[model samples]
Target: MALPSTTVADFSGKYVLNKQLSDESKFDDILAAQGVGLLKRKAVGMVSATSDVHVYADEGGVEHLDITAHVSGGFTSKAERLEGRVLNWTDKEIEHPLFGACTTKSKRVLPAEVDAAELQNGWTPECTAAGVIFIQVVPTSGTDWVSKQVWGIEEINGEKRHTRRFLVTTKKNKTVYARLVYDYAGPL
Candidate 1:
């Protein structure tokens, strides 16, 4: 199916997480590469987390994204703005079920790349709006991890929903270490 043509302006709303999919066996390698210890990795897998994404454009026409994730016994949030330049910010140290409490400086870039053919295959035109990418420098391990998250709108059972694809790459090899999928449950 051909996706409708859309721009960044179309991604202005709250997207709730409905589902998460990943390869369980590869979780170890993916987590260890980010400096996550064995015990912490196990904890990360046992806990369930729900993420809600909020996107909007500011007065200067810059796209902004705020992702709030609720996990077992705690929650964490990160915000980024895409305005063509690399924006830097410090993410508060938060205990993650998956990564533990590691703090680092985050770099974000807006309007990342999206495959046109992939977008046309049951994905929304708004998927192109998901070009926001984030990079984090791990202080302890000195590993640079990059993440690109995109959202595609699709109709499921006549109900409009959004599917988010998160890809994490290791800067050393530039290989995709992990891929996560999350479905939207309407607004917040």
Candidate 2:
């Protein structure tokens, strides 16, 4: 049976979801501070939403806060032997409106895997992955709250689209507070 999908929220192209004081320039500074070290591990910052440059508000009077923020901690290597490639992805799944995890793990590469020539000119490491892979870092370590996300697909007229909600929690061990309920329309 198909799931009962009632609402269709389309947050046009994309946007940034900023929390605290980390957005745009400040966000760039954070990356700069990491320098080459960034290639080593994972990092997090304010969710900055960037889209067409238009504002949208639902009938409820709440601003649609859906966005696709630029993420780092994607790929890096040393020793030059194709050690490992990383892919930093977010929770863009709809249905559950619950949680997500690091879909892709740092894996070593091989020459025979894909001709060295192809590797040198491969558009991106993600292109190498064989199947539909989703790389997301599940936020459930010790903190709580991972709700401000969804994955959307457009429709014919590009008016009412479909999307899935993604949120995370630490069992009953709650910490932060967040909610997911909005209608998104790209910038006009």
Candidate 3:
């Protein structure tokens, strides 16, 4: 557990998934909604994952964030580098073992900028007051679906936790919502 005084809301640090505190059971359903194959989903669900987050601002005043995902046995599973500027969606290709090729758009936004209720509500008051980071992911092939996720610092069980809420929507209109909570492991 991290001391409350040292936690940063900037979302920079190392965090390990607290499966016991997260709605992890719903992850499979969320993946399915995104058209992930059964075998891959099962493999992902069984592994313990951790995140190494880094947030910074360039000299031009543009903020940036990078998150590297590590799975069990010390293997890096995925990494995403997001720019924190509001603009039209610029689709970029990314490949992941579990998600495969996908296009993503990400930025930092004020609470008021978020129009989706699922992504806007339920943030910790501190984060809601400061701001939030948003990510939109779409598979480049297979069933058409979109996963919109909001990242913020949430106070859970008297501790500040790194939290993410994702809403997955398919072309058929099916949707799945899930929350992932991570325990502060240490500084990155």
Tell me the tens digit of each residue's lDDT in model 3 across 47-127.
788778777766786666677777774445555443233323466677756677888877777656876787787667767
Error of 1 at 55 (Å): 0.4
Off by over 4 Å in 2: 1-8, 20-42, 46-68, 72-168, 179-188
Better of 1 and 2 by TM-score: 1
Rate residue 25 of model 2 by lDDT. 40
Model 2, span 1-188: residue lDDT tens:
11123222223443334233122343333233323134321233322223332123457754333223333233232111111212223233232111222222312232224222312222222223321111123333332332222233223133333222222323354322222222333333
What local lDDT score does residue 42 receive in model 1, on the 0 to 100 scale?
79
Error of 3 at 5 (Å): 3.7
Give a tens-digit lDDT track for model 1, residues 62-155.
5555666655523243333322222245454544434444453333333333332322244444433443334343433355664444444555
Q: Which ten-residue region of model 3 has the weakest summed lDDT?
A: 80-89
Stretches of model 1 off by over 4 angstroms after superposition: 1-20, 73-123, 128-141, 144-174
Worst 10 residues of 1 by lDDT: 78-87
After TM-score superposition, what is the CA distance of residue 87 in candidate 1 from its true location, in Å? 7.9
Output the lDDT of residue 100, model 1.
Answer: 44
Cα-based TM-score, every candidate: 0.53, 0.23, 0.85
Which sequence of candidate numbers ranks them by TM-score, best first?
Answer: 3, 1, 2
Q: After superposition, how far is residue 89 of candidate 2 from its true place, in Å?
A: 21
